[model samples]
Target chain A: MNKLVNQINDLLLQSIPSSPLETNLEESMRYSLEAGGKRIRPVLLIETLKMLSKSDNYEKGIQTALALEMVHTYSLIHDDLPAMDNDDYRRGKLTNHKVYGEWKALLAGDALLTKAFHLISTDGSIDAQTRIKLVELLSDASGHLGMIGGQTLDMESENQNISLETLQHIHKEKTGALLTFAIMAAVTIVQPSDDVSELLEDYSQHLGLIFQIKDDLLDVYGDEDKLGKPVGSDEKNHKNTYVTLLGQDKTEQKLDYHVKQAEKCLEKLREASYDTSQLEYLTQLFYQRDH
Target chain B: MNKLVNQINDLLLQSIPSSPLETNLEESMRYSLEAGGKRIRPVLLIETLKMLSKSDNYEKGIQTALALEMVHTYSLIHDDLPAMDNDDYRRGKLTNHKVYGEWKALLAGDALLTKAFHLISTDGSIDAQTRIKLVELLSDASGHLGMIGGQTLDMESENQNISLETLQHIHKEKTGALLTFAIMAAVTIVQPSDDVSELLEDYSQHLGLIFQIKDDLLDVYGDEDKLGKPVGSDEKNHKNTYVTLLGQDKTEQKLDYHVKQAEKCLEKLREASYDTSQLEYLTQLFYQRDH
Candidate 1:
């Protein structure tokens, strides 16, 4: 897992070259991309591909993984803007808008988002049909119908009493969609059997829920030094989360349910003669991570 | 041209449906897109495809054309944000941020940009290879190395002296790249001969310059009613433009030069037995329009 994380970090660092033009747009883009998250999405993508293919020639998935990371990074940058969440720090470092002014950070985010498509489109390892599918899936996942829609709903729900269903819907689209994309993109690349695909999809859905529920849990219960920001920000911002809707104990129970379901899916995969160790480990990490 | 503009407008209107989710993000996106401009970019694309193919079956190019316009529209929305131009109006209507607040406007722009790629990827009329090529070209034209880079240079040059070369370079990327994509996308659709492609490239380059130079001229000498905004905002903003760098007469001369060069490219196309009348008329309109 550490090896895959290091590989993703290296590729991301090498992704956006310094522009010869007289603008720091590239610098601003690089700054956010280099700010260093856990690389969870890309790692999931690569690991899924590896587990399904049973081969180390996961090179074909690298560009797509990078593209997913880029999309995630762009969302973070925009979410940190003053017009959005307005955070000054992320991951123990100054946010993109803090390092590069608001406008530069905004454009940098746009550029990164645009470059993600460029990367997928130009990946020579993939066939044109697969590339098109990737683009379609990615746009649908990240566009208004998915992540952005969730963001809007989340924003509007602020300071208002929201139902449990509404909170789940928001988290499903806002965070689950991209994580599902990571797994599904790998599935798309590997072209598993229909039954296997269904199993993987089920696993991915459970994993997505586990990831977000844990995020809500960590925000209220995790260490600030480890999380790189203060806890209870969701409450401070009057934002609803799983913990808010279900209470800490109930949220923990919900998280356990999803983790068990995700593990069951992995067991099914293993029964079908696929190596599920990497993915099983990922499920545990999402279930137990501090950040 | 009017027919093409109307078609493009209708398509833009139908492109983004209202979200079933409890969010107005879709409305904000639709608002800016429906805030009518001339739809010059899409018209250029369809018209270019029409001229190149010598056939009226330009249906295959419509989605790509819409994609180009979305890219242009997204840039405008981002440009009008408070951190950028902070404009109150566009096309005689309230700018998106003014109408929808700042954060929603930002997300709308991001969504629109993502949808552009979605449009091209899902364009069934074109082959997968063609779709990939369109994605590659569109991203290159709009990403950090192109329009966004130009915008950064433009923003950084505010209140600073810049050379004619730098100013031209900035416009070439900032405004000209997407226009070039308008023409080049048509060429990509038609798969024209190399020589014809080269000629169209030259014409598009000149057209891009004509568009920007005329824009600079219009800022200084055109009527506010025609432009739907104040004329001297460029000067007020301390932004460097062709008019500021070269004065009105020389900027007019520059526009004229590009117009002639664009006409020459069209004449070459005509000699090669392609209908160039539409492009010739567009050149004249760009040269003579007040807005």
Candidate 2:
């Protein structure tokens, strides 16, 4: 897992353009890309590829994985803008907007999002059809219908009494969509059957739930030093999180329920004759992540 | 020209999503996209396709064309943000941030940018390679070292004593790159030869300069009632435009020079056996546009 994470990191570094523009948009892009997060999305993508036994072109998979990270990193950069989350720190360092001013930060985020499409489309090693498929899934997950929509809801839902259903919807779209895409990305590349996709969706949805619930838990109880940022941000922003909705004990129970559900989905996939160990292991990491 | 512009307008309206997220992100996207302009970018793209005789895939070409407009609109939305240009009026209407507030405005721009990739990729009628090529060129133009890079320079060069060459470099990149891509986009779909591409670059670069110079001229001497926005904005922003750098008479001379130069390149393409009538027509419109 560590080796796979390192490879994803290396691919991300290599993917940053070394163009001769006097502007530091590239630098701003690299600043966020190299901020040293868990690399969980790419790791999950590569691991899913391995579990499905479609690991023939590891380099190509890594590029798509890098694009996924680019999307994620760009989201973080834009979310940190003063117009949005106004975050000053992320992953223990100054946010992109903090390191660079708002203008460059905004452009950097735009560049990264643009680069994701550029990378996915130009990855010649991936079959053209699958490239199209990947682009479709990634953009759907990242654009108005998925992450961006969820983010909008997240903002609007702030300081207002919201339903558990609304919170779940936000969770699913805002963060779940991309994490789910991290899995679907591999499935598209592998060209798996529709049956595999159904099961993977089940697994991916459960994984997304667990990830979001655990995030709420960490915000309430986890150590900031380990998390690399303050833990009370949801409350600071008056967000309607799981902890706020269900209380700490109920939220923890919800987290456990989703973990068991995710494991059951993996079990079903294993019964379908695919190795599920790597995915299973990653689920454990998500379940236990402090940050 | 009117028909093409109407089609571009229709495509822009149809492309905006009516999803159920309950935030004005989509509203903001539509607000800016629906904001009336010359539809210059898409007109350039479609006209270039017409000139190159690749009008068979007109629907597919228009989707790419819509993506171009989305890119342009998204840039305008971001460029108007408080962190950037901070303007309250665009195309004679309240800017997006002013209408939807800053956060939704930012997300709307992000969504529009992401949707460009979505539209371009999901246009199944276009072959995979051409789609990939479009994605690459669009990203290169829209990302750093292209539009965003040019924008960065435009921002940085503000209130600074800069040279004509530096100003031109910024204009070429800021607005010119995507205009160049609009032409290259058609050429790629048509599968034109290397020599044609070289001549297209010559044509594209000059067209970009002419467009920027005319924009600067409008900012200085055009009527607000006709132009749909206030004039003297370049001075208000302290932007060192072509008019600022060359005085009114000299900027007019430069615009004339580029128009002639652009015509020469079109003549070269005509000699190379491609009809340059539609592209020639668009440039005349650029030359004569008061708004």
Candidate 3:
């Protein structure tokens, strides 16, 4: 995981522009990118690649992983904007808008998003068709149908009492869709068997739920110092969450349920003779995160 | 031009999302897209495709042309935001934030940008390699090294009283790069000869200057009714434009010079056996437009 995080960090730093005209744009992007959060998306993609293939072609998917991280980072930057969550800090650092002002931070997020597509579009290592497929899936996950759509819904649901189903739908797109794309992009690159691919898809859905639920739990109970940002933001914003809908007790049960389901899918992959060790470890880490 | 404008208007209407979750996003995008301005970028792309190819593949590139429009529209939406331009009107209609508020306007811009890439990535009429190249060029024109870079420069140059060299550098990327890409993307799709390609590159560079100079002229002397929004925004923002650097009379001269140069390149393309009538007419119309 550390190796993958380092690789992702390096590629991210390198992929952003170093132009004199847009140094502030690059600086704004690098500010959030290097703020030392857990590189969960790329780590999941790399681990998924390891589980699915024997050849060290995992190295080839490194660019795609980096692209995933860029999308994640850009989304975070945009999400923390004064227009959205109004977040002042993220991961113990001043939020992008805090450091760069609103407009520059917004452009930084735009650059990061455009640069993510730019990276994949220019990647010579990936064949043209594969790259297009990656773009298709990634765009679907990031755009109106996925992350942005989910975000819109998330904002709309704020201060409004919403159904549990709607909450799940929001998370699936806002959080789960990209996570699914990360794992599925690995599947697309490696061309795994239909059964393996199906299993992985199911695995990622539950993993997404677990991740979101963990996030909700962390907001409620995690250490403020280690978590790097204030908690109770959802409450303050009147935003819906797993904890809000299911209650803390039921949200805990829900988190446990999804984690176990994710583990079961991993066990099934193991039964199919796939190497599931790294994925299993990551799954445990998701359940075990304290900060 | 009317035909292309109507076609673009329809496609823009269709391309944006209609999801109940993001109807506001779609509405915000549609507001700018359907604001009834001249569809210059898409017209440039479609006309260039007409100039280059015979197989009606330009029909396929229509989606790409719409994507370019979306990028232009998205930029306009963001640029008109309270955080950016703080405009109350565009093209005789309310600015997006005036209608949908800041957050939705931002997300709508984001969705439009993402959807632009989505259109290119998922375009089946073009081959994957060509699509990849288009993405490469378009993203380059839109990302940090291009429009966004130009935007950042534009923002920074405000209140700085920068030089003509810096101002031109900013517009070349912010305004000129995408205009070039609209023409250059058609070149990529048609697989034009290197000579024609290089000529169009030069042509679009001149065309870009003409467009920006014309815009500066419009902002100074254009009708509020015909120009949609009020004029003098450049002055209001304290932006450094061609008129600012050269004075109105000299900027008029500059516009004429570029228009002549662009027409010369168009004639060269005509001599090279590529019919350039549409491009020629468009150039003349640009020179004559009062709005």
| Tens digit of per-residue lDDT, candidate 3, span B188-246 | 98888899999999999998888889989999999888776778988887888888889
For chain B alone, what TM-score does every candidate structure achieve against the true structure? 0.98, 0.95, 0.94
Q: Pick by DockQ: which candidate is best?
A: 1
Give one digit per residue, the lDDT tens place, for model 2 in B74-102: 99999999998888987778999999999
Scored on chain A only, each candidate's TM-score is 0.98, 0.96, 0.96
Quick one: ranking by TM-score, best first? 1, 3, 2
**Clashing residue pairs, candidate 2?**
none
How well is each residue in B1-291 modelled by candidate 1, as lDDT tens digits? 777788788899899989878588988998988996888899999999998889988988999999999999999999999999898988878999999999999999999999999999999999999999999999999999999999999899999999988988898899889999999999999999999999999998999999888888888899999888888989998989888888888888888888888888888999999998888888888888988
Q: Count clashes in each candidate, considering only residues at least 3 apart in sequence or on different chains.
A: 0, 0, 1
Better of 2 and 3 by TM-score: 3
Tens-digit lDDT track of model 2 for A1-291: 777777777778778866665767788889999996888888888888877764544665777888899999999999999898888888778999898899889998998898898898888788877787788889899999999999999999989999999999999999999999999888887767898888888889989998999888898899988987778978988989999999998998888998898888888888888888888888999999887
The C-alpha stretches of model 1 lying farther than 4 A from their native spots are none
Per-residue alpha-carbon lDDT of model 3 for A64-182, expressed as tens digits?
Answer: 88889988998898888888888887777799999999998898888888888888888887799999989889999999888999989888888899899899999999999999998
Q: Highest lDDT among the candidates is held by which one?
A: 1
* Order by DockQ, highest first: 1, 3, 2
1 versus 2: better TM-score goes to: 1
Model 1, first chain, TM-score of 0.98
